[model samples]
Target chain A: MSSVNDIQNEIIEEFNILGDDKESTIFYIMELGGKLPDFPENERIDSNIIKGCQSKVWLTAKDDNDQIEFLADSNTDITKGLISLLIRVLSGKKPKEILDADLFFIDKIGMGNIIGSQRSNGLAAMIKQMKLYALAYQTKQNA
Target chain B: MSLNVDKIRDQFPVLHQEVNGRPLVYFDNAATTQKPQSVIDAISGYYKLDNSNIHRGAHTLADRATRYFEDTRAAVKEFINAREDSEIIFTKGTTESINLVASTYGRKFLTKGDEVLISAMEHHSNIVPWQMLCEEKEAVLKIIPVNDQGEIIYDEFEKLLSEKTKILSVIHVSNALGTINPVREMIQAAKKWGAKVFLDGAQSTSHLTIDVQELDCDFLAFSAHKLYGPTGLGILYGKREVLESMPPYQGGGEMIKEVSFEKTTYNDIPFKFEAGTPNIADVIAFKTALDFIREIGKSNIKNHEDELLRYASSSWSEIKGFIPVGIAKDKISVISFNIREMHPFDVGVMLDATGIAVRTGHHCTQPLMQRFGLEGTVRASFSVYNTKSEIDQMTEAVSKIAKIKNK
Candidate 1:
């Protein structure tokens, strides 16, 4: 399994190749949403939904063999793609590893330029939610 | 006579700009109209020349600033055809203006079992203020139901009015749907029960001609920002008699006539409501914005905006998966729609990528959205400065976005 840094670096290189055109970047991001595994319909409830998002996003997590896996979905395609990127970098890692993970690739690939200003809040909220799941798993592990 | 769209667009300096490698197509006029060059200059000019606290000032700049600020109230009084300049008061924005009435007028007049009626399509500001008032006064808040076409049911509104109805406040033109309420008739009906009428003219004063005398509304609130002026400055036009009946909204230097530890006397009508140091520069600049609208004339501006809305609705209706949120026959300055299988936020982002600005989300009209069985719609509002070419660009971009999801 690749380290978190190694995964972020790989993702950054791919996004760098996508160039700086906002339209293309957004279109590419929407296209990337297709990479996410199908989100469970049963888990898409108010409790699972993240607050402070313009678009509705439902996030869930599970601990498998002491490794935390994050699952997320959004009503909007671009937001879905954004969460998929988070999942790509941080999923299948131990709780401590996920919690301590620094998402430097967000700035490196100029994700802010791609997602626009309003979506930046949703992206931040999503990252916080992912880390919160990791913290929950880490707490469970300690118990 | 029709307006010279090119000339009008040229007057707004902000229109001549690029966004994301494309010429910015600003269609978010309902949120806040872009300031014209004259309005912008007026703001800077005030700071450069006459920057001083208004009213009760002995200095030269203070007197000039005071005169200019009062001149805006006079201009607004004429623009809305108010009975007197003293009837017009300046607040921060439409939200504050509404809150002022709710707090001042509603607090004094309302009592147990009394009703404050509002329509379903009102913005959150309009609704929340009254809701807070109703909750405090032990009054019942009534909503006039809206039809599927996003218009308030006239029959329902009439039925909602009763002797217990103390005030009937409603939006003149819906920011979310652009439906123009028959406020003139509504005001006439409201008077039968002796209910004061407040028109949330935040969207109307820009696109429509507002003659407060003709409409007979007791109060009208609108923001200067939506009228191509500055933000953080709003006008509250109240009938002189009605304004005098209400108590002071805030306790501050300007709003008070005399102060003491035991007894305090408040100023008259407009000043009674206007508290603290006002938004002097913006208020002065607002006259220029109103002048910009006056020079163009409402009829000419309406014709251009109606043409834009007509072209956009017809153009976008042809696209697959295009669903219009509001289809009120008497709508103006707004076209609300959504693409099938796509969230409004997504469509808004896609349009922004093409430098076409549109408003998404609930538009602060959550109840209205719920009434339509929608979370939100993409609202493309037009101003006098908007052109058909801009609408055409938006149409193409929307069609392209729709195709992506529908396919």
Candidate 2:
């Protein structure tokens, strides 16, 4: 029931003290990616595909009771983990709720400093894509 | 290996430093070569002394800056053996230069059903712009497929050339694969069909000797960074006639002769394409880089790089379970390889720990990586400053990593 800001705050808290070392950061991200909720098969296609990212992310959303539930999977180990992190904040929320999630919370989470420029850009792209999904879902729900 | 490796290394201030607790081994020359102190000084000196905008400035500083900026253009014209200084246009980099032609020339000249012929081994920069252009113009993008050895299939390329072919843009050297394309032959063939050719000289400009007159390409594009100049600067060499004919890419100050609320005339050839405040410092410093290359002589640099490549090939190839990519007959100093059962990133990390800077992953040629059925490759590209001893260290480190990872 929490807004996107709350979810972002939770993500920031979760990312606290993820180490400065590249290997450590990678390991932490991998662990985070592994913990993401499983996505439904039916909802996965077209819009979920990310073009430039090194990771293969499959995103799916379902209306879980009254809330929006997101299931995201990635083939690349670290990237899959990134998908999991996205799911934590973005999943099990309403379309408007997810859309309202504060992206700037990444900096508070210490993930901003940890991730490379490319990965950060990828994360931003991921957030954007997910928001678009949420917007689409909201439109569909209204329809 | 005629280059005084020690002296050359000393010239590059960045190369002398330590990274990750080890002496830096810069093999990421393909991405961007480390600039020498002379180049750095030149850039700083320009800003320090003559920091005014060029062409229009009546002041002493303005006149000096303008003279130096145009001098680089003159130097670039000689560097590529272009017809005139006006033929060389300053761009942000090779990517921008290619996009300028693809957008402007493609828009003005090419129509529906006109074909844009490109090689299969092209970088994404070369591929995507044309793809965008083709989509916009309803034109066709026909690729000249590579052979097993990663060289272009000459027969296939020859067959594809037709009256419909409006443009043939190809990489003079494949960045990912290190395959030196037979652009001369391809350009000659394309010329028969009256097709204009744009050579992506991003990789070749650093290693191979380029003579636009000799290659006879309509346009040639390369970045200064790859040639030991500062980053954020590139040269776009186009035939004066062809450049004059094409519409300007950007509309702004410097690129225009007259600016009004009504119809405005464009500036002459080079400036017509170069819009806004140019990367003056980097462009001026690039003259030194060009001069540096000329002093070394292209053949000598090629010989040294070739030797290093040969040594690495012999040494690294012998490592158990080490798989080398891009075994083209004609190549510059790029060596892309993967180890058995080990991720390229892991290998890169291990190499980086030893202070060896190598590029990992698809190298921005994801489509090519998909074509090769590879996730990524650990790339060790060489320059004049790199040594056999450095390669030996790289070999030892790679062998140990492969053994540990595979086991």
Candidate 3:
């Protein structure tokens, strides 16, 4: 599997090429969401739900061979696409790497210009949830 | 006489600015209107010249402040055509006005098994207060169901109205759907059963000509912000008898006549409800908003907005996959719609990129959203200052967004 930085670099390169066209960037993000694998229906419960999002997002994570894998789904296409970006860059990485990653690509890609302020808050929320999952896994492994 | 659109637009300084790269197209009037320079200046003027605690102050500034504060009440009294100035009570906004009624008038009058009737199109402010009161008093809350077009079913409302229905509180114009409810007819019907009627005029005050005597609604509540006034100020109009009979909402400085450990007496009708220090500056400046509306005339403003609504409704209908949510025949200048398979939030984001501000969501009416089988809608509501060209810009952007699906 690719490292988190490698995936982030790839994303940054793709967004940079997309350039100042906000619409195309949004469309591309939504397309990425459409490509996300179907999250298990049984795992989509209240416990996995992310709070403070305008749209409902369910996220579940698992620890496999010391790597963290995250699965997420959102009712809205743009929000779903947003979470897919997180999953793609952070999934299949060590919990500590996932926690420590700077996520510089978000700013480099001008994600704020596309998502607007409120959705940026939702993006922040998704990041927080992912970090929480990483912390949970790190605790379980230590115990 | 037709309103001078350019001259009217010039009054609002906020409209002259740019958002992002384009000129701001503010279509979120239903949420809150941008204040005119006159209203803004009035607010600043109050602080500059006559800033003091109102009601009882020995200083000269106090006398000036108290007169200005009371002048707004008289202006509001004339604006709504209330019989007496004492009937108008100033609260924070529409939410506080409704909460005050539910707490004071509702709690004392309503009892177990009594019913409180509300329309499905009510804002959460109107709904939640009654729900809390119902739970507390063991009263049943009945809703007047709205049809697909977002108009209330008058037959259903008639059937629901009975002696058990103690209160019939309905929205005069729905903030979400823009449906102009038949409150006059509904109020007349409710009075037949000896039920008290309240009208939530948050959306209506700016759009329609309100003569409280003509409608005969026992209580009318609205916010100043929606009428191109300052925020944090609202008017709750109750009939003199009703205001006199109800208990004071809160026990505080202004609401009391005599206070002691042994016994305490409440003040007069309006003072009894307005507790503590009110939103003094905002309330005083709200008179300028009323003056602005009166100078334009409500009918002329309505005519201009109606033209915009008609033009927009017809123009937007041509767009592909454009599904209009609330298509009531009689409505204010508000349109709630969705493109098939497109989320309202995404539409809002795209619109913002074009410097167009539209409210996208349930708009604090979740039950109404549920009734329409929608999570939310993209709502574009207009005011007097909005232009046809702005509507053109919005529709063109929306058309392009809708086309994204086919591509």
Better of 1 and 3 by TM-score: 1
User: lDDT per residue, candidate 2, A1-143, as tens digits?
Assistant: 66667777776665565444444555566556557666666656767766666556676666776577767776555676667777777788788877877767667655654445666777777888788878988888889
lDDT of each: 0.90, 0.84, 0.92
Clashing residue pairs in candidate 1 (N, C-alpha, C atoms within 3 angstroms): none
Q: In angstroms, how far off is A100's CA in candidate 3? A: 2.1
List the lowest-lDDT window of 10 residues for candidate 3 chain B: B398-407
Native interface contact recovery, model 3: 0.27
Of 1 and 3, the candidate ranking higher by lDDT: 3
TM-score of chain B of each: 0.98, 0.98, 0.99
Best by TM-score: 1
Model 1: DockQ score:
0.81
Per prediction, fnat is 0.73, 0.00, 0.27
Give the Cα-based TM-score of candidate 2 against the true structure.
Answer: 0.80
Q: Which of the predicted structures, 1 or 2, would earn the higher TM-score when compared with the native?
A: 1
Model 2 Cα interface RMS deviation (Å): 4.0
C-alpha lDDT of residue B260 in model 3: 97
- Residues B213-309 of candidate 2 have per-residue lDDT tens digits of 9889999999999999988887889998999889999889989988888989999988899889988888889999888888879899999999999
Q: Count clashing residue pairs in model 3.
A: 0
